[model samples]
Target chain A: MAEFKKADSMLEWFDQRLGVVNFVKVMMTEYWIPKNINFLWAMGVLLTVLFTFLVVSGIFLLMYYKPDVNMAFDSVNYTIMQEVAYGWLFRHIHAVGASVVFLVIYIHMFTGIYYGSYKKGREMIWVSGMLLFMLFSAEGFSGYMLPWGQMSYWAAYVITEIFGGIPVIGDELVVWIRGNFYVSDSTLTRFFMLHVLLIPLAIIGAIVFHFYALRFPHVNNEEGEFFDFDEEAKKYLAGNKKESKVVPFWPVFLSKDFFVLGFFMLFFFYLVFFHYNFAMDPVNFDKADGLKTPAHIYPEWYFLWSYEVLRGFFFEIAGVSGKDLGLMAFGFANAIFLVLPWLDRSPMVKPANQRPYFKYWFWFLMADLIVLTVYGKLPPTGANAWVGFASSMTFLALFIALPFITKAEAKKVGGK
Target chain B: MKEFKILAVIAALVGITYYGIEPYAHHIMHPEVAPADFSFKTLKNVDTTLAGNAENGKVLVEANCIACHAIDKAGYPAIMPNADAAASYGVVPPDLSSSGRIYDKNYLANFIFDPVSAMHLEGKYTPESGKQFPMPAYNWMSPQEIMDIVAYLQSVTPKVTEGKETNKATFEAACGRCHDMKYAGIQATTPKDNLKAYMGATPPDLSQYIKSRGEHYLHSFVNDPQVLLHGTSMPRVGLTEKAQEEVIAYMEEIGDSKKAERESLGIWVMLYTFVFAILAYLWKRKIWSEVH
Candidate 1:
């Protein structure tokens, strides 16, 4: 085994016994990272830190939370907020952390696309990330239900009701997901298990695989330059090179990541302490009532884009329900993002800044997302529905037409 | 110098965050004050020197209220069914079993003296024009007699054993005649048109009143409806101090049983969080020092 010097006597002893020093050096300290990567690159590290906060704070909240349907709201509003020590802080951190996590993940995903991080050898890492995101969505949806507030109950009902639109086993699946005919005690219990235990374990497993896949590839850079680490290392060992653009992850990337993490923490703590209920629906403070539905039932802002897609269709087409088709469209809107790497068939693996057309299309997609988010909160009326349908169609069109557009743009530019 | 800068920035941020959150935290810690219009002096001019007799008040309530209201779980057949009352008075009279838990003494006494004047209903509609509310002025009753009746109404506790009977009497006597009790399975038997004609709008269900309106607001409103709402038809029941206490108790018992527990535990929870936050900050600094 190759040996690396350990500075501390205690660490050296542990390294000899368990190879701890080598593992840390290889995975972190000695790891090569692109020097030019900007703050966007720090998102992955920030996300990991945020996840840790969520899991730790979540465990504390779980200590006081009762998942029973009748007791869920009281347990959160009364017992957790009022009975347990620092329960309000933990509960707020966990709840608000979920939103911040999504915010960070969205930026992280966008950064990956902007830098073509998902191309070639990084496909597996990207796919794993997508899988992690799906798990996150599931975890978030289930956690939202644990509060059992008016919005929680209705959101669960509306989202799960979409499954009932499927042909054949649709009705059964909805019933199965809910554990009954409605969002009841059984649903709350199962969702509690998913939110606190099952989904988190799955997320951790996915993250492990994600990092394992990420380790082999040199991290993507803003210049979209691919550095072959083996070749670079061979040259250095042979004395053909004294220095390289590739920098050690420890002092360079880690410092940047920590600085960004500190800034994020400052903002995160601000939200947790001050504006904890920012963007939170006021109606959710009321306890769940199955019979008394609020006039406007909307999902959390994060889920609004897909929710708007679901609302775009109101009329039945041919023999099928438009809503069922809308459900399919919503599923497709999310599922299409997973296959984005394949859809963009551009030969050049370059940053979006270098690809004008791709940049334009990416901005279009972002605009579509923002519009959908805004429209999702509005009542699905005549003009809004038409606008939603048009934008949703454009959203799909941009993705489907990506390969052709990229090919044509590449031909015109006369470059790979 | 770099370390100092970083530390100073963090300290500044911490200070800002603390200052930013102080006002909201203070608001949460303190009791909320109602708007000036909703506020009223409680039992100010009433002679509290005369102690109320619950037993005597009960007799007076039986004589005065039973004609229009029912205050028992056995569902005493009302003398005027909701429909007849609605037809005669425009709005059906409310039940009174839980009134003791809902109203304070001074407002109740003032209301009993002159229902129309107390409710500020004199200019809104007139009896000569057949647009007046049904509740008659009880100004003829002495302050002591009114206090006794208030004491009797307040003494009637809702039967919680059946769960549904928890607010049955107070609700029937004060609010049930017009408003529906969805949770308790009681429906208003008043004709829809009569309610519309009399009250301008059909009364909303009151099962969730205490949860929605809160105790302090209810006290002021029940004492004098017009003080909080300029033209509400709900007349003052003229309750005294003891009666008011009992009524407020019932409302609290039914609506917010966990309130005291919630409030008492909150300060300790905040304290624990403050300590935990300090520990978390130290741990975070320790871990991040590896990279720095």
Candidate 2:
């Protein structure tokens, strides 16, 4: 027994945390990760990885590109067609990565929302994630304008110029933004700085906060249960009375995460390496001309819903043009999205616990988003007026009505 | 095992965050100019004749008119009231979307070469109209390039609508930061009480000012306002002589509907930061629990 204890003592000395050498053991021993984590729980981790990929690849491309209306297009082309080896792949990855990051974040957020991940102890994570999303969108917009392509210039012109429809100071603000009359070198440089440095810093800080807050409360399972660790199981492993119910990281959670990570990595590699040619071509392959507007000036696909909303308002509305109304509605929609976590303060975190009314909202919100996507891609004809009206209503319903619905449902579920 | 899972997740997150930060930083570090579709070869579809290629025309405009006449929907220049909107001698910059609608090629050519003819400084649009455009002449623009500009403007269309308020508020918010006060409403010369009533921080009403001020004053004011009005708030509006003439000729549309929003977020940022800090402090100290 004494000899067995001596060997155990050596193993115990090796099982250290933080400063100790048995770091892996210590992590396996003390950390309290839930056993029944689902695929949704892995989304946050995946998004973090995707964000890193976007930043690393974006830096490599920026080294050679210029941000002037005159030279920005050529510089991007030169990098892709001439200078950088497989530069096209890098650009595609960065572009797709941006969309993917948004995609992942949206899923993660929905998961959080569906599960009541913002209640009580997890509020900080939800808030931090919201901040990250806002920064990400800004970064995406600023970067989208960099290629100085037709789409890039038009997107910048359309979005930036949207501010000109304001009650006053429209033109001056527009000029101030462009740093000249239109999207010139100054505008490109300014946007470049913003996209790369300022927004990224904010994203990094927000992510740090997100994880820091998450660490204290860990992952909330789908069943909406407070963590209950088995101390007797812990003590049995520790050779003391405090037995722990902890599962091994390698065979259980690690295996699941690794499998998912591998599948995503394979898809990403295929996307970057094989099927890479895409439509960021206007700027890289063509020169920007203010007079020659494209037949369709659509935003990147992820921004389609809001873009559709903006385009739909080109008709007469409450003493305003469709365009002005579109702009206002689009802004309002985005503003709501930024504040969603706070807006949804439900106590339920799982499908079973959710009230039927909230469940209906959840499913329909997805349908509305799909409708907006379709609306964004299509031209607004007289025939589409009803479609526009319906799309707008759906967006408002999802944005404004659902929060109250969720709150009411939460009250009923809690028997309050 | 649970501890190990946590550590693995943390490591994975750190690795990914590093990857995301760099390229995203790079892409944003220098905004790449947006790409343009150079379908100049396909201009046949649009049925617009450009003396130069549309791409070249855009570059030419950038070099010439973009300094003053904003072609992009976003960069519309500040329009002062012309004699039409002026009290006695008021002048406003007209929207140039239909410059082709308003002027023929010969008139545009002469206007580009000499502002006096177009402004009718020597006479009027017709003696019956009794109105004159105080357009400064452009000795700098070549007649061919002037024709090209005409061609470009002919291709342009106006998309302005009713709710798009082009008011004093909009002008000050959008164009005021750069142009300063070369235009009228932007000038600090207006009395505070009048300005507050007109629309706080309103752009000056330039209709009478432009008509009475004439081409020479408009030209010199835009070129170097310090020479005319000492310590003027207007920055040197960097425009070529041709652009100055076109802009002066076009300051015609000013109304309450066409205004911009003042996007000063300094106050909001300060306010939010204060709120967040308070929240953070309360959260850290557990003050909220004690209250509850």
- Tens digits of per-residue lDDT, candidate 2, B83-122, equal 2223222222334544543344454545556554333234
Per-residue lDDT tens digits for candidate 1, residues B164-186, read 34344444555555666544456
Query: Evaluated with lDDT, which candidate comes out highest?
Result: 1
Of the true interface contacts, what fraction does each candidate have?
0.00, 0.00
- Residue range A233-352, candidate 1, lDDT tens digits: 555345443355565676556766766666667677767665555334445666788988876787876787788888877778888787877988888998998988788777667877
What CAPRI-style quality would you assign to candidate 2?
Answer: incorrect
Which parts of model 2 have CA positions greater than 4 angstroms off?
A1-31, A166-170, A229-254, A276-284, A352-354, B1-292
Cα error, residue B13 of model 2, in Å, equals 27
Best by DockQ: 1
How well does candidate 1 score on lDDT at residue A136?
95
DockQ of each: 0.06, 0.01
**Per-model lDDT:** 0.71, 0.57
Candidate 2 positional error at B273, Å: 44
The superposed Cα distance between candidate 1 and the true structure at residue B154, in angstroms, equals 21
